[model samples]
Target: MSSLPITLSAMDTEVRVSLCPSCDRSISCTTTVFPAAEDFQPPQDHSSEAHGTDDASPLSRARRAKHQACAIKSEIARLKSLTKELKAHHRSLVELSKQQLALVAPVQQLPVELLHEIFLHACADEEIMLRTIPYTILSAMSFSRVCRTWRNIALNDSRLWTFSTIIDLSALASAYSRPRGSWIGWDEVSTFKRLVSLYLSRSGCRPLGSLNISASYNEPALKAAVDEEPKLLPPSIFKHFHRFRDISLTNSVIKWAELRVRASQESLVKSVKIVGHNEPDMSTVLFSGAAHLTSWSQYVDDFVPVNLPLSQLTRIVTGWISYIPAFTALTQCRALKRLELSLYREFTMEEDLCEPEILELPHLVSFRLCVDNPCILDDILDILDTPCLKKLKLSWAPYSGVDARLTDDFSDWEWPKDEFSRFMDETKCKLESFTLEDLCIPPGVEVELRKQLPQSTRIVVEENSGWSDEEDLDLDDLMSEISKSDSESA
Candidate 1:
């Protein structure tokens, strides 16, 4: 190992060509020879003799030494000067490479349209960000700070600015309830309105994606909470109602009157979701005439508002709608293809009471009705008919939302199977799917019911699992325990 390193070290150094004296072998090797080695001698110092200072005084000797030192110092200074220039040259070469490479960067070559798409994708969670962050432009503003080009592109691309705003309930309520005469209160109101204006202007007349407004505080739990909702966006914002495509309002997110204002606009609204306790008056239509509406969700409890273009709607979802309102709104949906309803179903003895002129949803492919009362099924099936219905899902729940165990002696809870069979036969609709969830059904009846349906129909019966089993105790064993305990006590 020692000789191997020495051979490699010599080969790497400058080489020489020579003939070996002993064996006449050609040798090519470089030798490291010092000036003080056997073959070399340095010249003797003769500076003192030439200067005639061999017998000089102590001061003269010291002066000669100082002169020698000065010459050595000058040599070092000259070498350092060369080093500084070399360092600067190396730095310039490194920077030059960086500059040349940047000219061919992929990001630099990306077209503006492509770059705009990247920015939109970067803020894909626009709705989530709005829900969590107070500022609407924070995502845009953050991206803009990246570079001047991104700033220009993000600001000009109206699609990048289509966003949702989530305002806290308390702050929203106070913005309206407080007097604007006070500077502090006025500042808040103006600040909120300005935020809305900024969004509208940046969107550049593009179609607004969605407006999701929610209350910050729990209005039901607060003490002396204001009933008024802060119109987060000013009235001027609504002037561009044609831009709105999706809107969701919750918990008095906006005053009921604001909804009416939105209803009056000839907006190109396609989907709407409303969830609140205070129902708008039944007379006031949701969207006075929404021609473009195709999907709607109505989750209010009290009263159903009218304004929707029900005939143009294809999908409808409602929450706890009673018999009258359900019939009223559903009957108007001439184009309804999918219907989901949760109802406070209370049937009357006067089954003849008008049930909205037999809702004929010829286009309905899926129909799901949730009723707590068992009798409500008869009411619904009697008047409503969907000829093209491919899926029918029915959920039978109790008014308390829970039911006790099914027992042998319980009252007859079997829904009139014959009535359902007759209804399907009359509609002339061949169902492809059917689901019965959380209901009490007699044993073996599921198989019998399946036999009656069309061969193409897929049926599922989900029994009330919580209450299906009955614990039968033997009377002999129970009596023995009772008698034994009684005798011991006596």
Candidate 2:
């Protein structure tokens, strides 16, 4: 609180004094002037004269200054480089985002049902390659290239590969499962494993309709599937073998012997046609599942085989006719309506001595005789003695340069006209149908033969006008034309 002394010298000195201690020069200020106190110490004065001009301190200061300058410059350069990198990174990110958006936009427009139809078409035709479908659709290419949604759809469609319609077994084995090039050696295990995996995957998939495992050497896998789980072989697979309807194979898959054991269990199997080396020793239980069987054609290699009791058989074609001594053995088949002789060799010198007894099956409605040579008329009349016989089909080729009288080696044995008429009358007009093919009849005899078949709807008689002694005639075209004409007439 005591009044302090205010001097003019202090004011003037303070006004002149500098506040900046680090700077080289003093700054001007407008304020009340006060003289600096003598006791108050001032910053130390550093002048060029205080230090010598030739002192090493100057060089050291320059070195320090250069180091500081370089540090500052380096920091600035780093900042610029970082800025350029950041700009480049931002531009790339923007471009990538645009491309992603472009790819995603097109896929959203496709309908789910359209994709389903493509899968269906692929199942219908096995030959169609998956890539042929549109990119927007679910194809192998689209699934790989496009987004995840399409890939899921394509991979899920199991029917895509199930319809392996390949006819050639070797080609199919090499295509999907086996190695590309020729496989040599015992290292085929890999191929087998791959095939099993492929088939297993397909079997698990739904809607697989038809399958043909009839190709060669695949019988093991096929028979195993049928034997182990007959249900796996859907009815549709059997229905696909339209051309092979008349044929059956029960033995080759495993052995007709083994098949007889599994026959009752195979409810899916309608009919099976097979040729056995020996007569089947199995009981009729093998035929239990084949309740739907209407026809059976069996060829046994044994001299005499056991007769099959076909309950529902409407037609029976056998190769043992020549082996049977007489027709008495064939009458055992109660359901026999049609009989086809597989080894019916026309009257030969070796066989003529042991002529088989004429088979007169009372229930026989149709008879089919396949002959390598012309058969005698009396042999046919003996078979036609069955009153139920309505149709007769003969498969034979007429001999070249054979007269209508049948005097040549291929001539059909001729009986008197009265005897032939008597045999026809004895049949009681039961023979309503007759079929003859690949033969030449004399011009006048053709008309007479037609008159003999009074009730026949099928008449196939061809006059061999081209038969000559020098060159053998190609009867293929003529036979084909005759068949066509007969078929049209029928």
Candidate 3:
């Protein structure tokens, strides 16, 4: 066979060859027309004429076809290697372009001051900071890992590390119940303690934003640690107590005694929340020198005496106190701007009891009252005179015992409409917001209550007793705004 001509085109890049044999006309074929190895078929015969006599026999043709296929496969493999190299080069160029573009990104061009503010905003989520244990430190570390500039900024600016730190020792306590040599591995506990130390050190001289420590009293882990090992919390943490701004200790009674001992030194603490089965003594005056203490909250089973500087407080939330004691406590909180009280059980009405003297709270702007019995609500409202009150929230949960004969359901109970109206008129206060939770008032009564307040006042009433599901006003935000305004005015 002899080759006549070869043709090529841009659209079809494959090389086309024309062949002319001694006894045949011209035939055209492309390089890609060669059959793959699996598709190729060999002659079945092995006679002398097929193999040796004629060069154009089936055996000779098969051998030529096999040789051609081998050569084509070698060429195809070389081309594949070249294609792969080209693709790798293309990817490198793309990555280089992306890096160049990132260098001139708008965020990268922002001034350090603006970037600092943006970072603070990113870490301003208080709920996440409070709920997730050690997340405050983890979040700061994450910001530092972004880039060199971020790392420099995050490490230098102490505000990023000032989020509320919540250390929960309940898990550690549970881990101690195992066999003798197997306490929850010390590596984990050590790592956590190290993180806490690192977090505090990065805060510099700035006041600690908040510190929340919770552990159970029933767990012997804490007491055992105090006796036999180093404390679960690093000793360095207590050294910074004077700089603590907000503090919460729950369940562990020993921590309460520690705070009482350091009360005079905690001059920077602004808020304190305590929750437990029992606390130190009723007569013990904790935080005696905390002049900045403006908020106090306690959750206990019964009414316990407390000797705080109530005259200077701006916020107070008490748990389960009798009406007489609650009223007496309010009379001392003359500077209070916000007050919340939870009264449990029934109040005995004695005929010999004299009329309660009216208590006036001139600076009060917000009040929330939650009672299990509705019978004493009228008497409570009659005695309170809040001239500056702007927000009011009333929650009712009917007691379900044989002695609590007030009412089984809120719908059957009578609302103190006349008493509340008379109180409003007597105080001459303009309420900007009002809320009634867990009280299934009739539609008609709701309309009347709405009419008593200003038309612009925001009113919320949950009739089905599912108030927790609804979005109520955030009192903390309100009080913060008020405090800010007060400071600006001062």
Candidate 4:
């Protein structure tokens, strides 16, 4: 039989008593129950009612909820405190990483000297560097950003920071050829100043050995390049110019006033090569500025002038020019040791009436003459008197209608054989080597000219210097060999 469920009072639930002791003495019972859970009014919370701590009153249930809310609030405060501590630990770890980086950086592990050399190599060579007007950003500056140690070393070494200025022909064309009255930005100029500042501050007292300032352009590739490239650059950029050994500029004209300032400041520069400049009036200022120049390459204009400091020059190279200027210029170079001249086609029968004034270069040694016409060559040699001349090279460039040699044919032209013979006799110099290229000379005339010089003079001809065609080889191998010999002897 199913007995009706009995509800236990709160006191009976806590303390058990034998109410059915007379019926069954062996039966044991659990002390917790509240009317078999169906007596509770609330639909949920059977766990509270069945556990014998029954909160059947609304006031009792409210008090139990208040206690649970306080516990949850305490737990939230603990979690927030823990989270704050963890963040502080994370910040400390970040500081530790910075310290570790200093010890582990690769450059810090190497000696300072090796790193210095590596830094030097990272800087680009002056000759091949492009867009150098402002700076080579990635070339030298990249190494400085690797680490703090690297930055210090790179910044301290001045040699790595030296830069040669470059004038890009294409960019110059675009910059200068803008519409009239348009503003030009000083982007390139600013870049040059920053580079100069960084290099000078770091270099201390080290001399910048060499620099190249050039207007680079391919004339045949674009007409715009030739027309738009500036004839002369402003001298303001080079105002701080000082101690340098070599300065080479090509294909652009420059201010004579700026050159005068540079020459006055830099007296020890050994060489200056100015090629294809438009102005020849200021050539006097160029030589005057660089009073110690030993090597000079003058191709300033198609027609060169003669007012220059030839007294200090030991070497001189000229581009294609007529006979008169070459003769006038060579007359003053008393200290010249080596000379190379490029001659154009010029002839004058009137040269007979006025015997050209002869120039005596007592210390002259090596002379290389490249000519297109034989008469022009004869005209140059008649006036130059060199007593100490040793090495000589005569390069004949092939030209149309100029093929006829003055063997016996004087009907059309004049030969300065007597004038050349006279100059040779006056110098009385022992010629170590004489090189002739690209033209045939009669056997008798060759032997007679050789007899006038020292017996040891080696006469080289076109057939000997490995040239199947002169136009194909501009190097002139015979002259190259003679230059090598001169260098070795020196």
Listed per model in order, the count of residue pairs whose N, CA or C atoms clash below 3 Å is: 5, 7, 0, 1
lDDT of 3 by residue, 87-190 (tens): 56558767988998788687778899998998888776432222244543466778888788889999999988775666666655444455545535455566
Q: Per-residue CA lDDT of candidate 4, range 1-490, in tens?
A: 2232333356224422222222432222333332333233443556645665546656565565555456556545644554465456557756888888877776578998998998788674532233453343545676778778888887888787665555444444554455555443245433544555555565565555565555544443234644433332333325444555677665333453353355546555688777654554454454465666788886654656444567788998887776666666777788999888887667553653365476678898999987766666666676678888899888766333355543223234343568767777777877888777754454445555556656677776655223443432222343466569889999
Question: RMSDs, each prediction?
Answer: 15.8, 20.1, 15.5, 18.0
**Candidate 2 colliding pairs, count:** 7
Candidate 1 per-residue lDDT, tens place, 235-304, comes to 5555665567887766454454455364445667788887766544334244657678888886766557
Quote each prediction's TM-score. Answer: 0.65, 0.43, 0.61, 0.56
Pairs of residues at least 3 apart in sequence or in different chains that clash in candidate 3: none
| Deviation in Å, model 3, residue 21 alpha carbon | 60
Which wins on TM-score, candidate 3 or candidate 4? 3
Shift in Å, residue 377, candidate 1: 1.0
Q: Which stretches of candidate 1 lie over 4 Å from their true place?
A: 1-104, 116-125, 128-148, 170-197, 216-242, 256-264, 279-286, 348-356, 400-413, 463-490
* Deviating ranges (above 4 Å) for candidate 3: 1-139, 142-155, 176-185, 216-230, 251-266, 279-284, 345-355, 398-418, 432-461, 464-490
Per-residue lDDT of 199 in model 4: 57
What is the lDDT for 186 in model 2? 17
